[model samples]
Target: MKDTLLDLQDIQKSYDATPVLAGVSVTLSAGETLALTGESGSGKSTLLHLAGGLDQPDAGRVLLHGQDIGQMDDTARAEARRLHIGLIFQQFNLVPSLTVGSNIALQARLAGRHDAAFCTTLGHRLGLSDLTTRYPEQLSGGQQQRVAIARALAPKPALILADEPTGNLDEDTGDAVLSLLLDLVSETGAGLLMVTHSPRLAGRLSRRIHLSRGALAAA
Candidate 1:
C-alpha cells in the first residue's frame, strides 16, 4: 500500500464561535489526487489551510506523514511545513521583482532542495522555458499560474495543497493548467489535494469529496 502523506482526523475549527470545520476526517496517500468541492461559504479553504499547517485545528489532529504538526512549536511547525508541503494559491503569489526563473526556484531554494536540472525540466514542461527571463508583470494569467505550479513542485514536497490554483484563468486555460499540474504530480508521486469549484475540474482527480456547512457532505 502507498504511504499516507496527509491524515486529517476529526478536524474541527472555528472563528469567533463560527464553526468552520466539524469532525472532518480525510486522507491523501502518496501519488493520489483528491479534489475538494463545495459552495462559496463552505470550509474547503479552511481545511486546506489546516492541512498545510498554516492553521491549527481546534479539536483534532492534522498529521503529515504521521506527525502531528499542530502539537509542535511555532518554529518547528513552520519548518516541517516548509520541508513537507508545497502550496499553490489562486493569487499566483510570485515575487514582483523576481524573474520567472527566480520565482520558480524560490521555494526550493528556501527549503534547501534547489535542483537546477529539475527546475529547468519543470519550466520546460509548464511551457515557461522561454519566459524564464521575464518578470511576473510581463506574463499573462495562465503563464503566472504555471509559474506558481513550478515553484511549488521544485522542492519535491510529499504533499501539495492547491487552493483555486486556476481560479483566475478562463475555462480552457484552467483545464490546461490543471492537466499539467496533475501530470507532474503523478509523475513525482506527490499527493495532491486541490480546492476547486468546477465539478468538471474536480472530476479529473482520482478521488473527490464535497464539503457543506463545515462538514463533509459527500465522499
Candidate 2:
C-alpha cells in the first residue's frame, strides 16, 4: 500500500437514528483504485458522502491527506472538494444551461486554475471535443456522462469518488466510459474510491471490498 490519501476512522452516520454506517473505517492510498461493492441501502453512498466531504459523519473523523475533514467548517469542506477531490455520480448533473465546454471549465475557472491545454486534452480524450459547444440537453446519456466525467477530471484532483458512474449507460457505452475514466485516473495517479454494484467493473480495481448491512469487508 502507498501513503494514505484519505482516511475514515470509526465513521458512523445515522438518519433519524437509523444507523447507515457503524464504525466504518478505511485508509485510501495514493494511486490506488478501490472498489466499494454492496447491495442497495448498505451504506455505500453514505460512506462516499462522508469520505468526499459532501456530508459529515455523525461520529468519528475523516482525514484527507493529513488534514481532518471533520475539523473543517462547511466552507472549508466545499473548498476541499473543489481543489482536491473529484466526484462523479450516477446522474451526470450537468448544468442544463451551460455548454459542455463551460461546464468542464467551471471548477477550474472558480479555483483560478484553468489550464486550457489540460481542459482541451481532457475533452478530446473524453470524446467531447465536437460536443463542447452543445448543451447537456442536446447530448445523449453517454455523452452527458462523459461531460460530467470531464468536468470532474479537469481539476486534476488528488482523489476521485465515483458513485455508479456507469449505471445509466448501455454495456458497451459503459465499458468505453469506464475505460476512459480508468485511463485518466491512472494517468493522474489519483486515488479512486468508486461505488459500484457490477462484478465486472469491480474486478478491474486494485482492491475490492464489499459492504453488507453497513459493514465493509475485503473480498
What's the lDDT for candidate 1?
A: 0.90
Every model's TM-score = 0.94, 0.94
lDDT tens digits by residue: candidate 2, 65-171: 89988878999999999889889987787899999999999877776789889999989877789998999999988888888888888888889899998887788
Q: Pick the candidate with the highest TM-score.
A: 2
Residue 10 lDDT in candidate 2: 95
Clashes of each: 0, 0
Clashes of 2: 0
Q: What are the per-residue Cα lDDT tens digits for candidate 1 across 24-109?
A: 99999999999999998799999998898888889899889899987788898889878988999877889999999999999999
Per-candidate Cα lDDT values, in order, are 0.90, 0.88
